[model samples]
Target chain A: MAILLDGKKTASELNETTRKRILKLKQCGIVPGLAVVIVGEDQASQRYVRNKHKLALKLGMNSVIKEVPASITEAQLLALITELNQDTTIQAILVQDPLPKHINEQRIMQSISSTKDVDGFTAVNVGQLYLNLTGNYPVACTPKGIMTLLEKYDIFLRGKKAVVIGRSAIVGKPMAALLVNAGASVSILHRYTTEIAEYTRDADLIISATGVLRLLGAEAVKPGAVIVDVGQNLDETGHLVGDVDFNAVKDKVAAITPVPGGVGPMTIATLMQQTVDLTEWGLANGK
Target chain B: MAILLDGKKTASELNETTRKRILKLKQCGIVPGLAVVIVGEDQASQRYVRNKHKLALKLGMNSVIKEVPASITEAQLLALITELNQDTTIQAILVQDPLPKHINEQRIMQSISSTKDVDGFTAVNVGQLYLNLTGNYPVACTPKGIMTLLEKYDIFLRGKKAVVIGRSAIVGKPMAALLVNAGASVSILHRYTTEIAEYTRDADLIISATGVLRLLGAEAVKPGAVIVDVGQNLDETGHLVGDVDFNAVKDKVAAITPVPGGVGPMTIATLMQQTVDLTEWGLANGK
Candidate 1:
C-alpha cells in the first residue's frame, strides 16, 4: 500500500499557524482582510466563497462577500476589482472563476491589481513568477499548496525529475516554474504531447492536474514514483476521484495523495495563508 | 555518419539578412552602434573584442572598443557601463566576461541597462528571457545560435524531449528556459545530477555545453538524438574539441555540430543581429 499524502492534516496545521499570526497581528490593531467577489451565485462558487469567508473569520480576519448580478459587464467587474485594488482596508482580492460568458474573462482577470491578485492569474503576476521574483503577488493557490506540501514532507526538488501532466496556466505552468526554480528537472505534458508516458514513467515525482479521472494507470507510472493528483472528478456514484488510477497504481507507488483528502484542502489552506500574508505586508509596508 | 550543423554557413545567411536591415536604417541617417568594453587586456578578451569590432564594421555598423586597466574596481567598471547606458547613440553594449577576480561579476553584469545590454546579461533581459516576455531584448548569443540551427534543420522543439547537460547562467539556464517556453520538455542536468544517462538517453534532442572534451559517449546518447555541441575545448595539439565523443557517437546520432565551425560564428552573428534590432527599435520608438 502507498503511503497517503494527507493534505487535510497538513492544511489544519497551516490554518492553525495562520490563526496564530492573525491573533498576533490583531494585537497591533491590524486585521487581515479578504474581499471575495462572485457573480450570478453559481452553487459551486457560492460554496467556495462561503468556505473561504467562514475560514477567514475563524482565523480572526475581516471578510467581505460581494455578490454581483449575472448581467454585469466586464467593465463593471473590472471597476469593482479596481476599486478593491485601491481600497485601504482590503489586503487581498479574490474574484471567483466562472463569470458569465458575456464577461471578458481575460480582461477581468488582468484588471485585478497585481498586488491584491491573490489568485496569481494576472500577466504581471505570471511575469513575476516567471522571473523567479516572489517579491509581489501571491502565487496560484494550488501550486503554492503543492510547494508547501513538498517542503513539509522534506522532499528536496533539486535535480529530481518532475513531470507535470497538464499545462493549465493556473496550476501546471506555475507548478513547473516553481519546481524548476527549486532546481528540479521539469517535463510538462499537454494536449500536444504524443508520448506522455515517456516523460511520466521515469519521473521521481509526478504531478497530475489534468482533471481527467484515471488518466495515469500502473503502466504510466514508474515504481516508487511520488504521485500527487490534483484532479477532482466525480466517480460513477458521484464520489470524488483523481487523475490517477489509484486501484491499479497505488500499491506500485511509494507515496500517493488521495482524491478528496489530498490537494483540495491544501488549496483552501493556501488561500487563507495568502490572505494573511497580503494583510501582514499591507500592515508593515502599507501597500 | 551524422550530418554537421554548420554555424558559419547558417550565420552568414543570417548576417546577410541583418546587413540589409542595417542598410535600410543607414538610409535614414541612423547608425547602429555597438560598444565593446574590455577590462584587463587578457589575450582572449582582446581577440573577442577585435572579432566583434571587425564583425560590426563589416555589417556597416559603428563599433567602438574601450579598454580599461586590469586594476579597475567593480564600481569603476559599473560607472563606465552606466555612461554607455545613458548614451543614446550607443544602441548596444557588450562587456566581455571572465573579469578580474577582485570585481563582483553579478553586480557588474546587472549594472548594464536592459535596452543597451546587447550581451543580454542584465537582470531585466534575464528576467524577460526567464519569463518568456513578449518584448525583444538581446538574448544570449549561444541560445540564439542554437535556435537558428534548429530552425535551419526544421527540427521542431514543441512537445519534444530536450536534455541540457549543463547549468551555467549564460548557456544552461537560459537554454532550458528557451526550450521550455517553446513547449519542449526540458531537463537541465548538472554536476549534482545522479542519473544523467537516464535523462539524456531518452531525449529527442541533447545540448551539451560543459566544455569537457568527450564528456558524452555512445552510452550517454541514444541513436538518432539530435546533438548540439556548444562545448569548445582545445586538445593538447591546440585543436578545438567538443563534449561529445564525435568519432564514437557520430554514427549513432542523427546530427551533430563540429566544435570550431558549429557554434562559434553563430554567437557573433546573433550579436550583430541584436545590434541592428536595437538600432531599429531606437529609431522607431526612441528607446
Candidate 2:
C-alpha cells in the first residue's frame, strides 16, 4: 500500500509551529497581521477568507477581511492595495481571486507590494522564485505547502524526473519552479500536450493540478512513483476527489496525497506560517 | 542531411526590420536609445560592449556606452543607473554581467527599471515571462533570439518535447520559460541532473546552453530532432564551438544551429530589436 501523505496531520503540526512563532513575535511587541481583500460575494472566496481569518486569530495574529463591492472600480481597488502596502501592521496582503469582470485581475495582483505580497502573486516575487535567488520571499501557498510536505516526508527531489501537469500561474508554474530549484528535471504538461502519459509514465514524481477527475490511474503511472494530486474535483456521486484515481493507484504508488486531507489543509497552514515568516523577515530587516 | 538553421542570415533579416523601425521612429521625432553599462576593463566585456554600441549606432538608434572603473562601489554604480533611468532619451538599459566581485549583482540587476530592462533580468519582467502575461515587456535576449530563429524556420513548438540544458538566469532559465510559454514540454537540465540523455534522447527539440563543449553528439539525440545550440565555448584546440558536436549530429538531425554563426549573432540582433520595442511600448503607454 502507498504511504498516505497525510496533509491534515502535517498541517496541524505546521500550525503548531506557526502558533509558537506568533507567540514569540507577540512577546517582542510584534503581532503579525494578514489582510485578505475579497471583491464581490464569491461564496468560495468568502469561505476561504473566513477560514484564513479564523486560523490567524487562533494562531495569535491579527487578521483583517476587506470585503468590497462587485462594482468597485479597478482604480479604487488599486488605491485600497496602495493603502495596504503602506500599512506597517500588515506584514502580508492577499486579494482573493475571481474579481469582477470589469476589474483587471493581473493589474490588481501585480499591485501588491512584493514584501507584503502574502499570496506571492506579484510579478516581482514570481520572478524571484523563477530565478531561484537565495533570499527571503513568499511563494504561492499551495506550491510552498507541497514543498513543505515533501520535505517532511524526506522526499528526494534532486536529479529526479518529475512532471508538473499544469501551467497555471497560481499552482503549476510555481510548483515546477520549486521542483526545479530543488534540482529536479521538471516537465510542465498542459492541455496542448499530445501524450501526457509519455511524460508521466517515466516520471519519478507527478504533481497534477489539472482539475480533471481520474486523470491518472494505476496503469498510467510508473509503479513506486510518488503522486501529488492538487486537483479539487467532485465525482458524479458528489464525493470530493483528486486528480489521481486514489483507489486504483494507491497500492501501486510509493506515496500519494489524499485530496481532502492533503494539499488543501497544508495550503492554509502554510499561509499562516508564511504570515509569521514575513513578520520575522521584516523584523530582521529592521522594518 | 539536416538543414542548417542559419542564425547569421536570420539575424541580418531581423536587423533590416529593426533598421526600418528606427527610421519610422526618427520620422516621428523619436530616437530609440540604448545604454550599455560596462564595469571594469575586462577585454571580452569591453569588446562585447563595443559591438553593442556599434550595432546600436549602425541601426540608427542613439547608443551610449558607460564604462566605469573596477573600484566603483555599488552605490556609485546605482547612482549612474538612476541618471540613465531618468534620462528621457534612454529607452533601454543593459548592465553588463560579471560586475566586479565586491558588487552585489542581484541588487544592481533588480534596480534597472522594468520598462527599460533590455536584458529582461529584472524580477518583474522574468515574472511576466513566466506568467506569460500579455503586454509589452522585455525578455532575455538569447532565448528571445532563439525563439525568433525557431519561428523563422517554421519550427512548431506546441506539443514538442524540448530539453533545455543549464539553468543560468541569463540563458537556461529564461530559455526554458520561453519554450514553456510557447506550448512546448520543456525539461531543464543542470549540473545536478543525473542523466542528461535520459531527457534529451526523446526530445523533439533540444536547446543546449551549458557552456560544456561537445555535450551532445549523434548517438545521444533522437533522429531528426531539432537542435539549438547557445553555447559559445572554445574546444580543446581553442576553436570556437558549441555544446553540440555539430558535424557529428548535423546529418542525423532535422535542423541544427552552428556554433559561431548561430546564437551569437541572433543575440545581438535581438538586443537591438528589443531596444526599439521598448521605445515603442513606452510611447504607447505615454511614458
Candidate 3:
C-alpha cells in the first residue's frame, strides 16, 4: 500500500505557520488584508468566499467580501477592481470565477493590479510565473500548494520526468511551470493528447487535474510513481473523486493524494499564506 | 529524400503580403511604424537591427532606430522606452537583446506598453500567448514565424507529439506555448533534462533551439519526423549551422527547416507583419 500524502494535516501545519507570520506582521504594524469580489450568486463561489473569509479571520487577518449583483456591467466591475487596486490597505485581490455570461472574464482578470493579484490570473503575473522571473509575485494557489506538499514530502524534482495531465491556466499549466523550474523534464497532456500513456508510463511524477474521474488507473502508471490528483469530480453516487483510480493504483504507486482532503485544503492554505506574503512584500516595498 | 520546408520562399511571400497591407494602410492615411532600440555595441545585435530597419522601410513603413551608449543606465533606457511608448507615430517597439550587464532586461521589457510590444517579450504579452488569449496581441517573432512556416507547408499540428529543446524565453518557451495552443502534446527539454533522446525519439515534430551544433542527429530522431531547426551556431569552419545534422537526418525526416534561410528570414518577415498588424489594430481601436 502507498503512503497517502496527507494534505489536510499538511495544510493545518501551514496554517499554523501562517498564523505566526500574521502575528509578526501585526507586531510590525502591518495588517495583511484580502479582498474577494464575487459577481452573481454562484453557490459554490459563495461557499468558497465564506471559507476564505473564515480562514483569514481565523489567522487574524483582515478579510472583506464584496458581493455584486448578477446584472453588474463589465465597466462597473472593472471600476470596482480599479478602486481595490488603489486601496493600500488591501494587499491581495481575488475575484471569484464564473462571472455573469455577458462579462469578459479575461478583461476583468487583466484589470486587477499585478502587485495585488493574489489569484495570479493577470497576464503579467502569469507571464512572470511562466518565464520563471525572480521577484515577489503570487503564483496560482493550487500549484503553489501542490509544490509546498511536494517539498514537505521531500520529493526531489531535479532530473525527474513529470507528466502533467491537464493544461488549465489555474492548475495544470502553472504546475508544469513549477515542475520545469525545479529542473524536471515536464510533459503536458490534454484532451488533444492521442496517447497519454506513452508519456505517463515513464514518469517519475504524475499530476492530473483534468476533472475527469478515474482517468488515471493502475495499468497506466509505472510502479512506484508518485501521484498527485488535483481532480474534483462527482461520481454516480454524488461522492467526490479524483482523477486516479486510487484503490487500483494505491498498491502500485509509492504515494498519492486523496480527493476531498488532498489538493483542496492545500489550495486554501496557500491562498492564506500568499495573502500574508503580499502584505509583507507590500510593506517592504513601501507600497 | 525529405522535402525542405523552404522558409526563404515563404518569407518572401509573407513580405509581399505585408507590403500590400502597408499600401492599404497608407491609402487610409495610417503609416505603420516601428521603433528599434539598441543599448549596446554588440555586432550581431547591430546586424539584426539593421536588417529589421531595412525590412520596415522596404515594406513602405516608418522606421526609427535609437542607438544608446553601452553605459546607459536602466532608468535612462526605460525613459527612452517610455518616450517611444508615447510616440503616436510608432505603432510597434523592438528592443535589441543582450543589454549591458548592469541593466535588467526584464525591467526594460516590462516598461514597454503591451500594445507596442512587437517583440512580445513583455510579461503581459507572453502571458496572453501562453494562455492562448484571443484578440489582437503580437506573438514572439521567431515562434510566430515558425508557425507561419508550418501553415505554409500545410503541416497540421493537432494531436501531434511535439518536443521543444531549450527553454529560452525568446524561442523555446514560446514555441512550446504555440504548439500546445495548436493542440500538440508538448514536452519542453532543458539543460537539466536527462536523456533528451527519450522524448525526441517519439516526437512527431521536433523543434531544436539549443544553439548547440548538430544537437539533433539521425540517431536521436525517429524515422519520418518533421524537424524545425531554430539554432544559429558558428561551426569550426566559421559557417553558421543549425542544431540538426541535416546531412544525416534529411533523408529520414518527412520535412525539415534549413538553418540560414529557415527561421532567420521568417523572423524578420514576421516582425514587419506584426508592425502592420499593430498599426491596423491601433486604428480600429482609435488609439
What is the iRMSD of the candidate numbered 3? 0.9
DockQ of each: 0.27, 0.77, 0.74
- What is model 2's DockQ versus the real complex? 0.77
Model 2 alpha-carbon drift over 4 Å, by segment: A69-76, A86-89, A284-287, B285-287
- Which candidate has the top score in lDDT? 2
Clashing pairs in 2: none
Regions of candidate 1 where Cα sits further than 4 Å from its true position: A35-49, A64-85, A93-138, A278-287, B36-46, B64-82, B98-114, B117-138, B282-286
Predicted chain B of candidate 3, TM-score versus the true chain B: 0.98
Evaluated at residue A157, the lDDT of candidate 3 is: 96
lDDT of residue A194 for candidate 2: 85
lDDT (10s digit) by residue, model 2, range A1-287: 99999999999999999999899889999999999999999888889899999999999999989999999999999999999999998999989888899998999998898889877888889999998877999999999999999999999999999999999888989998999899998888998888898889998999999999999887779998999999999999999999999999999999999989999999999999989988999999999
Q: Could you tell me which residue pairs clash in candidate 3? A: none
Task: Please report, in order, the local distance difference test score of every candidate based on alpha carbons.
Answer: 0.84, 0.93, 0.92
Question: For all the models shown, what interface RMSD does each have?
Answer: 3.9, 0.9, 0.9
- The CAPRI class of candidate 3 is medium
Each candidate's fnat, listed in order, reads 0.24, 0.81, 0.74
Worst 10 residues of 2 chain B by lDDT: B211-220
lDDT of 3 by residue, A118-237 (tens): 978888888998888989899999999999999999999998999999998888888988998898988989999989888888999999999888898888999989999999889889
TM-score of each: 0.87, 0.94, 0.94
The CAPRI category of model 1 is acceptable
